[model samples]
Target chain A: MKNSFSAMARREAAAGYLLVAPAILLFLLIGLFTVLFSIGLSFYHLGQGSLITSAKFAGLDNFQNFLFGRDLNLSRAFKQALVNNLWVLLSTLVVIPIALAIAVMLQRISKGIRLYRTVFLLPMVTSSVAIYYVWQGIYEPEGTLNKLLAAIGLDSLIAVNGWLGELHTALPALIVTVIWGSVPGMMILYFAGLQTVDPHLYEAAEMDGAGAWQKIYRITWPILRPITVICLIMGMNGALQIFDPVWIMTKGGPANATEVVNVLVYQQAFVNGDMGVANAMGWSIFVLTFVLSLISLRILRDKSE
Target chain B: MRGKHKWSPVWMLVLTMAVILTACGGNNGDSSTGSSDVKLTMWHWKVAFDPGFKAVADAFKAKTGITVVTQAFTPDDAYRQKLTGAASAGDMPDLYAYWAGPLEGAFDGKALEMGPELEKDAEWKNGFLPSALQGVTVSQANLDTWAADEKSSDWKKERKVGQIYGVPLDVGAFYTIYGNAKLLKEAGLEAKAPATIEDWIDTMNKVKEKSDVPGLVFSAKTFTLYENWFMNFVDYMKNGEESFTNFMNHDEKLSDPNHIHAIKIIEDLAKSGNILPGSVSLDIDPADQAFAQGKATYDIGGTFTYASLVAMGMNPDDIISFRVPAYADSKVPDAKVTPFPLVQMVVTQGGKHQKEALEFVKYLTSEEGQILYANGAFDLPAVKINDTSKLNGSLQAMAGSLSSESNWWSENSAISGKIGQPEWQTFHADMQKVILGNMTAAEAAEDFDKAAAAEKAKAQK
Candidate 1:
């Protein structure tokens, strides 16, 4: 009876493998294969047109070219890109905490809570590019921001060139836009986390003579820590990959003030026609993003412990 | 645990593969249509040329039993991406418009060498403006040599060079100071045609001092018309025709004391308060519109932007263009800022319909054909056509300056093709700093010179 049962189980396993084979094959051929191929192309010197006909075995030269200054001035461009990315990453750290605070505030409101939640979540659903362009219009020389400043007798604060045009303000202006767009999704995440939190703990803290701030510190944070970690991870990932605001607003102009690594990779691939270096840059970016994300996760884990 | 089974769905992986495949799907090709008759396909980004191309196809069909199919894609980069992919697959449209630069050079034997045939026919050759032919002209060196491997001995031959890649579509000065004819008249500036740099400055300053409207304006945000044309003016000020030839030969940097002088000239113009207040922030369209709506008196523009001015409801007669005049302390006294090659049409070697394709190109560049094309497209012709009576104000301005304006760097200049624009962008960034009062002219020159030298080294590599 045992032997017969084992034989039947083996047959079922074979059937299952057969059923999933097509999906596995498709993924290997198109999705994972493309990524693997791109990684391989990073080591080859693929010049401008007709990639197959023109490429040569370049080894680590492409990677070296991007990171170190070879014959080309790509290193400077990359440096600018890294600087901008740091700005985004640092800005997102601040943004996630603010989002959490807002979510906590929303939790306290009893009447018309749904309306406030809906209003807060509106930015998450709106198109990012549309929001960016709207911000652009507001940042123009004769745009709404300047007009408002002028009306308030704070006209001296308006940038000589528009906000997006000036080197000093372009990245800061972009950071504001990204934070504005990102806050809502994070609010929703915290809100969901807040619901899952055990209400008994907060009541227990209250009975122990815990104040509102003390209750939040003792009960609210410890329970919602996982959500905070998730938000930080996603926030950091999103910030590092910022392209649209800079592309639409400045084109990395006014002297490469707002150029991020992603934009650099794109320009190298498309504009500069150096796909080999572009791929190398892409791999580096992926590695950097992974390491940073892992570090964040580790730190959060340690802090909780 | 004698037997176990675990099979969760790879749903995310499947979905990702599907998206990637969708994005990598092939472009919809314009395959040959007519049966029996000799069939051909032509591609371009000039959608305006559709009517003219159709008429020419009809005419060609009447003359010989052949069918010509044409397609146009726009916003340029999309068209280029498509062409690049097509070239990789060894599928090229029989005839297509391409820019004359390193991109064209990359397709070595892919394109048919029309130069030998073009040179053999004198009547055909003379009909073309020398500058037009020179615009698309480059060295005969095969691009297989330029492949990253860098092996060329098999096809290499000494003492033979200068190949014309394709026939130019049109040519003229790329950058000009276009006056609002009405505004200039109203401002009472005696600057109908600027004879010198001082005269141009005086005219702009007069408009600044007298006119109720804004003064000199140009798009300075991107390293495009403003920086490029400024460099052209500077280069002209720096190099004579021979010295510029030497500059193209990679002997001279386009930055020096003379170039710094050029920067200061523009800086002085800005300091004069003759420039529009927020000109540094505006894009090309808004800058052109500002001048057109009587917001500014004089604006710098190219062939394309000049058309935008007219399109924005500015009268044709109200728009007048003049060359960037030679400055007082210049070596190239007769220098005028000239146009780079715009676009070229080539017949690829692998296409089955080569004869028919060449015939179409020949017809399209002929006097009659050029006239029809000019009328259809609202631009000048590559060939020296007799009539300019039908051309618009912008084209007329472009055509009128053709005789005096010299194309400073021919397309043959490997320096310009390899790293000119990239290096120029760095220079432009410094130029911006100089203009914004962040950097001095001397400091800008030093930084710009370093960048240019690095680029020149890259190009040599």
Candidate 2:
């Protein structure tokens, strides 16, 4: 009997191992290989002839170059990218809250709420490339926006070109696009969070003579804190890693006004072919993201606890 | 505790075995097991070149029975990223198309020397124009007219500093300008194109005043429009000296009066309501579309625009070319109108199949291949072919007119060295500012000088 029981347990264990084996193998093959190889490559000088045939060890030289190199202005680019990322982050924080409020209001309404949601989320469902093209038309000097300004009798203020050309306005213009693109997702998250809030708490607050603003501030906010934090962190991370929109729309143009860190890293790696420096930059971005996420999580955890 | 204990050793054993398996599988499949045949994999971004290139590959295969695989990348930018990544990862294709200039600097010492077959191909050697050869040759040795003694001659005096590293596939000329004849007729102007910048401006103003169409359209989303304008304006303003000299020689000062004047002209074009409003938001494709749809009178573009316009269903006859004229009052005697090359292809040094690759390259640059490209793929042939009867009507006209011009240049040629220069970008932005009435031309010029000086200082280090 004991021998039979032990045989059964062993068979079950073998079956479990077999089930997970593919996943483990795939993870190691795709994810770990690049990570380990990149870590190894970080220590070597990868130039033209030496790319395949030879590798010379130069410990931390790549990192040193990233931090302070003569040949590459990585440090300056990184600083500028970080500043651009921060702009995106701050803008998202401001915009998402307002979008969430609008979403919550629309959710409460019985009529035309579906229409509102559909219209609000229309930009999200549309392809980014298409959206950028449409915006491009609207932003043209004699395009709809300028025409509107002229109609309003602000002809002197009618700068026909989009905000992309001006260094001062380019980042802000991109931020508006990012905010417009991201709000729908955030709004949906907030709506889901609102649905989970107990009706009794709101009723109790209302019974206590709490106004709409007061009730929201006192009851709804505390309950939605977790979702808000998630939204905030994800939004910031997304904004930090913004590459496609900036790449397609502006290409970090008008003098690197829209140059985020990812754009810089991409240019360094692909455009410039400075892989070693690029890898270092990638690692730096990874570290920055990890640290930022951790800090955000810690603050959230503390508040929740 | 019991479950955890059971899982620990199992996980360890599984991980170890997986590692071993991965190590075994990590071998790249490039190593030939027993096959003596050499297989070359070539990647290119040109979809149009595929059929012609495939024919050459087929011929090579018939001769050697060594398979040549050709892969085309969609969307050139994505292909470049992939190629760069592959190059860095030591897994690049055997032969691939690459751009010259700053892109060439990326793979500096890493390109293959062509074999005897290519060097001995007399037809290929004699077919290419002198300027086309200059664009491809990177080394002094490969040049037709190098200094007699390398040691005695000044480095600057050397005819060429690098070998002919790439096959001259196409002549990327910039003199081609596309204007909508329909728009011109609507504006009550004759089909005759403007001869000078002043006349061009006058015609544009008249068009704007008389018609509903925008005067001109260009993408202000990036510096492409600004750069293109600057390229032409620099030629006119400096009588074709300041910007080109500054770019070629690192030691030359960038903040010359001519460059500043060029910036002023671009700014004036923007400020004077000549350029389409909201151009900063428009990109190349949309801008081209605007021109094709008769929304704009002129598009300052290249030979590729002809193909694009035809693809958009516009009649080729309606799209006419005009040469941008010299400055109305210029001191330089030999100033000629020129435009920049759009693209150039090079082979990287890290490639394995150098000999076979060079053979393939030689085939691409041959007169037969160029003619094929010109006929089927819409490429402006690099070589001046004897037979002009087979050429497209517009191209034939362009070819006829091109010989009379004295200057030939690429757009990026002026600021080539200052590609990554931050001040160069600032210069572009300042030009925009000047056009917006935020700064004067002189202020813009001073700013450019300061930026150029800073860039020069950085380069010196």
Candidate 3:
């Protein structure tokens, strides 16, 4: 192997390594090291504001507190947060079809396709904090949603406490915001995939006496399956790690109705200063997310095949 | 071509390395120009107080020939992160301000013990009110609570009482309420303090009936505000010191009818329909802004709320302020609000300019410094000043409200430490449920007792 490279080749390889050295060093120090450190920290009982070197090893105690019922309140909060995360994940069912429908509609239109795409992608590119605030205003007790409901003679349907302020509506309101932010990238993916399908294939389907729905189902659906998988994976990850929306809008208020795992992790780590338990809960979320992603991937791949 | 490529790669590597090295290089030159000259760095999270702090620092520099550099960090949680990060890097400033609360336990061993120094200057020590001193001073109760903590290290367990780690710049009473004078007059109500909770409720209802705006508003979205800040005052007022102390110490359960009634009084206020709509979602600043904007007639906040209300363009003369009204026909009917230290200034344990930093701390807490800070920042001072007329517009009113005779719970004290965080969080959420009319106050009280019991049981284990 050494003999295979001439002096010039060896020198070129050295230069390449040297060129990438700083980046590799940074990744190791900032990214990979912190992750490994958090994993190690999950098993300890570290007091607040103490140095990491002073952390006391507590074995599985940290995990047991939040995962099992060693600390009942913590365990209950974690369970509630997990359930909220599932609700967020389940929202993708509504999100995917709407996004796919928009992609299909955008494809049929001949004019202003780029303008439509850019408009659809605005939420994805916008600052999430600013968007959360806008949604917060919309979800206020006298906000646009309630006012619209009132105007439509559905005044009985308005939430008096605001959408983000009630137990029944907070989670759903957050899910709506999540879906609104999530759909654009997914729609763009479907749109790009739709662009690849030959127009002649659709023409052939039309000549075969297929209706619009049938053509969409037979020709368009199968081609978009891979993109659907990607969307599902991304959506699942995003929902599980959802923080900014919940933090800004609700802060998991009105008695933990909208509490999600990441928000709980933040409370435990920064607010409560229970770093060990926070890290344990974080790892637990990672494991759950990994398993869920893997299952979804396998099922989707099997269907695709 | 091969020869050119070889040297090009070599030269490029050298250039990149030089740039990287230059960027990462530390300044090896000495920062201190003179051996006798002293410069101290202080950090705080108060953005409004930054200019005042700079002015005070300038005064200190002129008087003592010591340079005090003040920096402001905003939005408390981020400031905590900054302090912790700087601590980890061993690059924390000479002095920094921190909130005096259960959270202060984090800085236990990290802050320099100022008890001996404070003792040396009896005047400075006595200048701050006894209530203001409670936050910085570690009482036996504090030591006992720390000892009982499962995570307590040897230093914490061995710590004694009378250990002062910091000095407060100002004292705050969280149970203070402010009324919009224009709205009050419009409602045909007198612009005076309500003597009882019932009177306050009646006044709010009158305001609601007569005016377009709602009568009452607060940061109800802050889950801790109702239970921790407001209800504690109600409990102390209704049940008196004995019952409040027992409940705080976890010896008495919140499920008792006495505590339940306190919760019921707050629930009644909510049930009156005079609370601003969407208040359950409004945060602290927005609620104050609501009162300032004449969207609401009344607001519940602390001494800190005045500056923000004024900043929002509310006229100081048009504002009527008072403590949270006492419960009528209850124990301690004459109960008044007590002011406890809101923020503490401390010397870092490993600071380079310890002596100068201590001198600055003394100056900052001095009578002259308090007047300078209070007037400049539009804030209340910790020290008792004889000439209240010298203070700024609304601060004089706030300073007058601080009485030496009033007794109240201090969140920064050990009493708060005894209530476990999990229990406080549980009670906070459940109390919100009660206020929302989703659950009865009795039911919430029962839940709170259970949560406290569970916490105690876990602590025992």
Candidate 4:
């Protein structure tokens, strides 16, 4: 009976691996393989042919040219895009704390609160293209923003050819759109995290003569740490891969004021047909995002424990 | 603990290996597995030209019993991206069409050159105009590996230099300056083409002053418009073609005083408020809309712009095509327009059905196939048009220029595509600065020169 039971346990374990095998293989094939392949490709100069025929080895050169080329052409472009990407991330991060506060406020209010939350989440459901176009209309020269400025007799504030076209405002305009689009969903995460928090903590803080600000500082923030970290990770990844709104609206134009890293990498891979440079860019972006992710984790470390 | 324990650190190493293994396995696609099949696949970016292709495809199928599958990718950029990826994958269609430049050049040696057979067949050889045929022909330089002294044996084993890899599908012009007669009439000025740069400016300023309209309008947001404009102005300088040729040969600096001065003319016009306000942000469609709404007297456009303007509700008679006016102190006595090929078809050697694909190309280039294309798409097929009276006004206008005007060479495209000219992009960027008062034209020119030198150095390495 003991021998039979051991055999059955082995069989069950084998079956478990069998079930997970396809998932592992597919993940390796599609996700992991592509990442590793890009890293290998980054070391060579490949275009116009497959790897067996065309690619020539030049290890670390592609990376060097893009990051620290003499002309400051590719490097400058990469740096500029990094700045733009960081702007998107930082601007989006600013919204999370504000969103958490809003979620907390909504949680305390018990009457018809679902309706407010639903309205707030409406933009999250709408397509990004549609939302961007709406924003584009708002920011156009004759658009609502300019009209509002004109109405308020502050006509000088109106940007020439709309805000998206101006170098000074193009990235900032995109950041605003991204933050608005991201807030509702992030707010929901915070709101859900708020629910999981023990209500007694807030009550205890109140009993200890804690004001609203003190309750948030002492009780609310501590519990929401994990959720904030998750949001930051997500926001960083999203910012790094931002392509849609910029492409749809700017095409990285008005002198490339909105040329982010992803767009440049895309241009290299497809438009310029320089896959090596593109792969180098991909790895560089990965390193950046990985560093950012690590920083987020460090920020969210359980310091008290 | 259970989750963390299950995901061992060793699994990370396994995953990394999986990535490398997968990439190595997935990347090297089946190379040139041209199977014996009567089915022909053709790829193009013109969805509007579907009926034209279908008519030709149907005729070919009826004649040869070969099935032709056609796929169309719109917005051209998507089409190029697919073609580029497919080339790496060895999955390019049996036959594909592209504008003759970096795109068609990408498949230069990979394509079956039709030089010998095409030269022997008088009917096929004589069907296309010289310029039309020239657009699709692959020059020696375009075949980067092909040396001037290379023997026929060295030339793809069966082909030599000066061979044509593609045949033209249609012809069109770029950078056609459209004069709005309606707007000009409103300004109480005669609607006609100006002969000199001063005259053009005078006419534009008169319209701007006399009417509530800008003198000119363009989708200046993109680099293509500026690049084309820059070329036109450069063509007006002393030894215009020689200068252009020298520039293409990489001997002439992009920041030459003459080139910078030429660009300055356009910059000055914009700085003087001749171009529409916020023109830098306006795309082609919006600029066309503004012109159609009578907001501008002159707009830079292409062959399709006429149809677009008409479609936008302008009368055919009100629209007229003229080459951009030239500099008075220029070497060229008369400025002429240049009409280039719109599309060309080529059969890839990478695929199996080469003979069948060639037959279809032959059919498409035949008189009947050409007629079907012209009638259906309202486009001028590459064939010699004995009678263009029945053609649409826009097409007829383009065809009329074919006899008198020069044909723009594919040289610049080849050179620029090959060299990765960073200076052109820099020049394009600096024009914005020039107009915005951030830099003078001279400063932009100096930067352009520096950028060119930098690019040259980079390329040499």
lDDT of 1 by residue, A9-96 (tens): 9999999999999999999999999999899889877655544555667888887876878745677888778878988988878888
| DockQ of candidate model 2 | 0.15
**Compared with the true structure, what per-residue lDDT tens digits does model 1 show for residues B1-461?**
53344433686688789889654542211223322356788988878767777776776665555678889998676887788777777788888888754236336367777778798878777787766676665544234234322222212222135566578766645557788888788787553778777777777777777865656778877565665555554454555555554454446654544345646765676667766766666778888888888877888877666778879999988888776666766787665444555778788875888877887788788887777777667766777767777565556656776662334454334433433456666767766666566677677767766777786677567
Winner on DockQ (1 vs 3): 3
Q: What C-alpha lDDT does candidate 3 achieve relative to the native structure?
A: 0.80
What tens-digit string does per-residue lDDT give for candidate 3 at A1-305? 66666877989999999999999999999999999999999998766656555567889999999888889888888999999999999998888998999998999998998899889999999999999999999998878899999999998889888888877898899899999999998999998999999999989999999999999788887888889999999999998988999999999876888999999999888887778999999999999899999988888884546
The top-ranked prediction according to DockQ is: 3
TM-score of the first chain alone, every candidate: 0.93, 0.87, 0.90, 0.92
Residue B428 error, candidate 4, Å: 1.4
lDDT of 4 by residue, A1-305 (tens): 99999999999999999999999999999999988888888998665322224566877888887787754577777888888888887876688877887898889999999898888888899998988889988877788988999999998999866887677887888788888888887899999989988889878888889999988777778878878888888888889988888877777766777889988898777766678888889888989899989988997877996
Q: In terms of docking quality, how is candidate 3 classified?
A: acceptable
CAPRI band of model 2?
incorrect
lDDT for each residue of candidate 2 in B238-336, tens digit (9 for 90 to 100): 454554555434344334554444665666676667777545556678778878888778876665667777788888778876655445655442344
Candidate 3, superposed: residue stretches over 4 Å from native: A1-18, A200-222, A302-305, B1-36, B101-108, B209-215, B405-412, B416-420
| C-alpha TM-score for every candidate | 0.86, 0.76, 0.89, 0.88
Worst 10 residues of 4 chain B by lDDT: B145-154
Q: What fraction of the correct interface contacts does each predicted structure contain?
A: 0.29, 0.26, 0.41, 0.24
DockQ per candidate: 0.22, 0.15, 0.33, 0.15
